[model samples]
Target chain A: MIKANKIEKTYSKTAILTPVLNDITLSIQKGEYVAIMGTSGSGKSTLMYILGCLDKPTKGELELDGVDVYGMDDDALSALRNKKIGFVFQQFFLLERTTALDNVLLPLIYANKYPDDALQRGRKVLAQVGLEDRVEYLANELSGGQQQRVAIARALINDPDVIFADEPTGNLDSQSTAEILDILGHLHQEGRTIIIVTHDRTVANHAQRILELKDGRIAEIKNP
Target chain B: MTRTIRIARESVRMMGRNKFRVFIMMLGIAVGVASLTLMMCVSKGAYERVMDTVNRQGPDLLQIRPGTDIQTGLPSGSREVVSLIEEDVSAILQHVGNIRAAAPVKDRKEIEVIYEDKFTLTRIFGVIPVWAQIRDFGPREGEFISEEDISFAARMCLIGQTVKKNLFGDLEPIGRTIRINNVPFTIKGELQWKGISSAGRDRDNRIVIPITTYTRRLFRDMHLTQIVITVEDTKKLNKTIKDVRTVLRDQHKITSGEPDDFAMRTPQDLIDLAYGTSRSLINLLTGIAAVSLLVAGIVIMNVMLASIAARKSEIGIRRAVGARKNDILKQFLIEGLIVSLFGGLMGMFLGMGGSVILSSLDVTASKITPLAIAAAILTCGLIAVVFGIFPAKKAANQNPIDTLKV
Candidate 1:
């Protein structure tokens, strides 16, 4: 679960400031499926990054599982990202020359648990994502759909409590996008908390709740 | 099983993959080691050649000549008619603890040694029978004159190979009649050729006769020219020389304030001085070689820095995946160490081979001390680590996000 209150972020030394996220507060409980939807430059990705502990908010009270994430050091933030959160990128960001299994094992490198069991868990996650036969294949050799599944397997490698996906199917075709949506739906049914950042209405429609951002602030919250 | 080992293996594999670079690096080290080894071999060979020529005279052998005063630029009045009689030689033999043997020698120049119609002007040496053993003189034919020959003043002479060639030619000189200074004497033995001394004096061009015959019959009651003393052991040569000087001064009744009439020398002293000079020369050559090795280390460091720069993306990926700073540092350091280790091994093989080849070619064989090899390896290893630090630190300190951006 992630909680942020009055979050603000800015870049550069310009007095004419462009805020990526401004005075916005939100909290997501465990086992909830939520979507943040916005057009380009509307700050949805920035909000997702802050929520994932990848970037610190300029001014905010942010907590994850009752621990003050905003007050944590860089190593602690990395640890939180490793143990408590998983990220699935839109572009599938798989290491280009490495096998799908190796790409999936990347997240567990930071995990404190037994790495052998984590590798076994990664294989299981790949099987769950319908990439069991393609685990040994490289990212460039796999179809776009399969690469996204490998990224999903990588995000699930550490068995994180929450999965944050940013435009998870933006680069996929209709068939591949449908498969990714079905995988997300299955994960939500398994009682895993999920937050997706996207511009597509069809992708947001699958979520239990949707938050729309406009010009660095949350415009509206719609319960599905 | 450790991650560090895995990283080291990976680094070695990478070095192997870049064969040309590794070869260039190794070439640098090899050239340095080879030059060092060769220099040491040649210098040591020349030194030993000189030493062998000197030692062939005898162990504990010393040549005492009158010393010249440096400030006056003239021969010092240090040469005294020390008058080394047979009794003096006996006293040194009996009283000096470390003296193995002693003999008094008188060199008579421009002496005509004639046998049949053949005649030659040669240097004649009047010496005791122990002089043959002390000077390592071996007879090619017949036998050396005995002590009884010297006591009875028998006119028996040992002719050197050159003397036999000039005075007797193709005929055997043993028992042949020879005239020294027109005085009749029988040739008792023929000395084998001993080439030349390091001082460029021909050792094979002299005739030796009994000291009693030369002192009484040739140079009547003359002062002895030189006293040759051979010590029992080289380690105690200085002590023996000191004791001999003390006894001679006491016999001559020289007061404590005046300089003694005799001079003493030791073969070990000459050997030590020669070896010391040679060692310094070897060290100088090795020091120059070390500079080149240091330059090679710098080259390796530069190449490693380039490698780190080129592999920035790969490093970024590893760091992003939770590799600690020390892990990255270790990886780069291992790469440097692998390069240097390979270079060091190749250099050792090449250096030893070169030394063998040089020795086979009649050059003085090089002594490859374990200390030298250990020093070379340790220096290479240390250079690798020292030069690797900056590049490794650079690689380790890279920000993953900035690196991943491009």
Candidate 2:
């Protein structure tokens, strides 16, 4: 459901030429679980950002669901991000002062669909993530595992086709990390396409396909 | 929910969190509005007080005196000496459609009024009986001289409260005789107290007698010094004055180009002029107060900008959660509005209280009007919005990624 051809991203200034992503080409079909694995400074995050429509590529053609995302304006790109993709961050990035229910309802605010059932849907997602009793608790009051569960609940609130998990288990304990991996596997089995960006081999092993990044280019793609 | 309302509510909540800052902000605006209200009340009250005094004297009473030339600042042309005689007064009353009543007046020098041993120097006024009604002075005891007394030239007089106090010394002066300039005159009545006039003349320290008796016995044809006329209605006073002036000019036979021998005045004219001056003074004072309110609003804007900077991460989170740029702008604008609203309310109350206290202490205070309150609130709202724009724009323009980075 997503495609990129010769995507290039660069930063300006200074005599030395520096590129964050150079001539990267990739594509992923619907319901495919993919992992982009890279160490620091390997352009994995930049690629993830481009795919998420959060930033524009310096030079490229990007198509999502037959729409040229690269040609979309800022508002259209934001709308695409809201409707087509859900993001889960390493820090769980839930609003600190807001309750778990409200955190999950955030994406629905932009979607403007099923607004009357937003609270009910958020509650259902929280229950699915095993956070039924912590729906009203603030994000800061939750443990790393519980916070990540809330993030996952938020990702599922809009029932988006693709979910982006960037270093999702980076800050969690091993047991919490395993639980999050199991949830990702379940989501994948449910026919939701999932992309996880991480450096951990165990995390990458949960994906159906793994793409490794070296410097600013994709080194290899391995079918797990 | 509507974006502005949501932002206003959030702004209120934020203000609630920072109690001390809100308190300081309100203090500045309250002081400005309160002082402005107080000054307006005092000036209005003083103007009304003066106007009331003028009205009580007579509605169409004109004091034609020697005019001081603007170029030289001196009495012009030998004082003109165009006395208001009984014939002139009668002519105005007969010819002027709106002239309800008119009377001639003359006064004697300070004379000794004695009842047995109690005595005092008092002004003895030579006035026609109709003058009493025109001047708003009614008898507190018995009655003023009648037309019969005027025709018969009776030796009777109406004494003022001060004269009664000095001559009778707690005893009723009616039906008793008082010596005025060594002439024994029966005290027909005691005049009611009428307070002081705008010209600072005492209205309760004079004795009144029929003009016929004064002209025949006290001062003969001293050119009937003044004419006091009461118009039928206050609204038609200008027309009455014009008619009276025309009659006077016809009687005196002064040609169109010649300076006339009379002047006309109305209580409404004096009242309006005094009110205008008072209103201008109030506007000036209010303008100064509004400047202070603007300064206070600016202070609020500066403080809110600093707060926006400090809460950058909070803003980023809100924005990431679907808050539009307009929402952020509304939040800060609402904050300013909240501060100004509370401040304006408090100031209004403070102003009212101040006016009441001042009036109680015998200071003149203006009557409070709904228009004034509405104006005060509107001014405060405008101040909030005008000063709030800069801070709100600054907060709205912050980039979510950059703000969230730290």
| Best model per lDDT | 2
- Clashing pairs in model 2, backbone N/Cα/C closer than 3 A: B41-B366
iRMS per model in Å: 3.9, 3.7
Candidate 1 chain A, poorest ten consecutive residues by summed lDDT: A107-116
Give the CAPRI rating of model 2.
incorrect
TM-scores for candidates 1 onward, in order: 0.68, 0.75
Write down the worst ten-residue block by lDDT for model 2 chain B: B66-75
Write model 1 residue lDDT over A146-184, tens digit each, in one string.
999998888887778889898989899999999999999
| Model number with the top DockQ | 2
Error of 1 at A199 (Å): 12
What DockQ does candidate 1 score? 0.17
Candidate 2 ranges beyond 4 A from true positions: A4-28, A31-63, A66-84, A88-156, A164-224, B1-60, B66-101, B108-111, B151-153, B198-202, B215-225, B231-269, B272-285, B326-340, B389-399
| Ten-residue stretch with the least lDDT total in model 1 chain B | B66-75
Residue A103 Cα positional deviation in candidate 2, in Å, after optimal superposition: 4.3
Residue B366 in model 2: lDDT: 66
Return the lDDT, model 2, position B155. 83
